[model samples]
Target chain A: MTISDNDDGGGTTVVAGTTGRLTQWSTKRNRWIDAIGISAAIAVALDVYLGIWVTPPDKVQGNLVRLLYIHPAIATVALYVAFPLAALSSALWLWRRTRSPFFDRLAVASVETGIFFIALTIVTGSLWGRPVWGVYWTWDATLTTTALLLLEFLGYIAIRKSTADPERRARRSAIVALVAFVDVPLIQSTMVWWKTLHQKATVLLGSSSQIHGIMAMTFALSFLAFGLLCLWMIINRYRIEAIREELEARRMEDAINDRIAESNIRVDDLLAANTAPANTVRSDI
Target chain B: MAPFALLVLILFAFALGPDRTPLINATPGLFWVAVLFSTMFAIQRSFSLEATEGLHDSIILAGIDPAGFFIGKLLAIGAELGVLEILTAAGIIILYGAHVTSMLVLLFSCVLGTIGLSAAGTMYGALVSGMRLRETLLPLLFLPVASPVLIAGTRSWQAGLAGEHISASPWMWILVAFAVLYICVGVVLYGPMEDM
Candidate 1:
């Protein structure tokens, strides 16, 4: 099978006979991705172990502080890492010099992965909130902004699905991504002025004065774990998007070929009728 | 837009029941909420005017500056929303028995917030105008982006109604900043969006 790389502007490439070389290249990349995923799982498991078993209970909150190992890391990946990468990719797609389907695919993959992590962040935060904040939710600035970001990105996905044309979909979603990204600053600024029940950032900002020793180590490890997981998920999602595009292009090609074959058969039928004197006479009548 | 705004205000009364106290206290929020909802319809109508007749393409082909087209639509929608807001405010005052203690702050918030809403609405309206699912998609794409306006507008009005003009000033600045930000963005980006 051959697929034209119109969307990516990378020129045409055959898919079948070159399978050996392609598989070798892809397998090498896949090995790295799999290794990252494995390490991520190990890191997360170790972080959990260290958090729940090894680390001493907090001076104030005791075992509840164990949530520190999970929630902040996921939030960091979702809000700070995944979203910014998506937005930057979107900007690159919008800029004429840097425009490519690669950036569009990256943006979509990052957003979808970010959505997953955002959902996890919210769930873990809610679970942690219930025992500490005494409620599952609040109208705090961080919470409200996070919820809105989720909705905005969900709209991004909705807009992506609204168009069937790949080019149009990429362009439209790129615009939406940038527009939604404007809210990030608005959210951050609100976190400063608005009274929030959510705790301030301590670990990531190097304000480890509040949290130190094994707790900090576990926290950093959790960040690395979730970050790697986020990257793995985005890479896999990007591959899925690329494969889906190729399948769509191949299906379109097969459809056009079938249409041409059908039209040729119609022409042959007309030629056969014209050559047959009896059928021609009946047609005259 | 005016009728829709009035309807929203009236519906809030029904939803809140016969208690005038809560309605009176919620007047500021209720009025802005009404305006926000009506702004969606206003934007829909504004874009539909160009869309139904394919005027969007004509305007682009006519060598009209995309920025001018953006600002023109922004102003038109802004004006319509301004009238709708006035009617909603009156409905709140008469139906909900709400008193406005600082008219200046209320007016400033109305003007600035309307500018922000109309600018953002116009941009989003253009973005989704060419889509088949625009009616459903516009609100989804627009409302969350406009939430800051809703918050800032409601808070400013809350302070305004309470006669605390000084306290309302900061929120008005937020309104100003949002308005300026969206206007500049719309002006620069409208050209490319139109090309799409």
Candidate 2:
């Protein structure tokens, strides 16, 4: 392996392997990520304040409605944003022409972030449900599908971790993602037909007439905040994954080099012993 | 497979207690659950058969079409699970004193459910075929994907037992859709999976 210094302005270090594949390392953090992270934090704090203090309690749901700002937004990110992005990246990785480590890393990052959001969604939703629904959990359609999705993606991560070979791991996890993606709709449809207690979508589906004006605005803000936060988390996770893969590759290359060096030393010792006098060899023994 | 599934049926009865009423009520779901468990074993056995003696490599070297190989395994596992289902169903009927009203619905659901389970099992079995931890990983990967089959199968069996043919039809259709979907997916994706 040869390290070719590409003097690009991006501060990327390109390592070209014997296979002629160039691995680019972006070691610098982007200013945009910091801006997005700061903005996300601010937006979330403001939304939480407005949701808890400013918005009036619902006549029916009472103060329990406060959970809506974060729960639904987190759920939306988990199901709508993160899942589709993971699935899309997995598909891109699977395709022959568009196949790249970038997509595989993105898929893993999206899945990890998605799992975090899913756990948050479940926890927040359960916190609200305990008082209203009288249960922390139920086998309702929405909850069941979300739980199943969590398990499926957990399995995806398991399969990814099971293999040490990067190429095999990428291919296997991509297939698992696609399979899980295809099952999501089927699981949703069957679960809906089986049973449901979760409320229907009212805000984002253009049925906002049911919600008050300020409440709707806060809801939208909550989504924006969570969306930005999700994006920031995925980007960071992707960078971490990239760095981990680079380190693994380097470690593997070093191990191979060490093995080669050891073998070379052994061959040199054999040659020295063969070329040396027999009496010297006996003395060494 | 039959003995294992029958043992599962007996174990369910033991766990549910001696109350015949609850046992009868739970028979439909328990039977399908038994089938699901047996399906995993059947898949593992099918793949392990290939794993031993390097049959998978030979099959590849012999240039057998992957789609055909997948379908063949699907059929073999499906047939094994089908027979096991019959044994378990009989065990449930005898031990749990469950009554079957609509034999047609019961048979249809069993056939459709077997296809779905076996199709998915074969796909996942092939996916983790040569892995070291496949025994644990396969169920983690396979069970959640096969939950829809469990739901549809149990519902259909319940309706069939209650003599509600109309109610059973929709669930059977879900079973049909599930089987068809997984079969098509297996046929298309199995080739790539085998390549891996």
lDDT string, candidate 1, A142-249, tens digits:
888898899999999999999888888888899899989976676555544555767767554664568778888998899998998999899888877776765675
Alpha carbon deviation, residue B51, candidate 2 (Å) = 0.8
Q: Which residue runs does candidate 1 get wrong by more than 4 Å?
A: A1-29, A191-194, A204-208, A273-285
After superposition on all CA atoms, how large is the RMSD of candidate 2?
A: 4.8
| lDDT minimum window of 10 residues, candidate 2 chain B | B1-10
In terms of TM-score, the best-performing candidate is: 2
Off by over 4 Å in 2: A1-25, A205-208, A271-285
What TM-score would chain B receive for each of the candidates shown?
Answer: 0.97, 0.97
In model 2 chain A, the worst 10-residue window by lDDT is A276-285
Question: What is candidate 2's CA lDDT for residue B87?
Answer: 81
Please, what are the lDDT tens digits per residue for candidate 2 over residues B54-140? 988889999988899988899988888877877887887887788889999999999989999999899899899889889999999
| Alpha-carbon deviation at B121 in model 2, angstroms | 0.6
Model 1: clashing residue pairs?
A: none
User: What is the lDDT for A93 in model 1?
Assistant: 92
Q: What is the lDDT of residue B159 in candidate 2?
A: 92
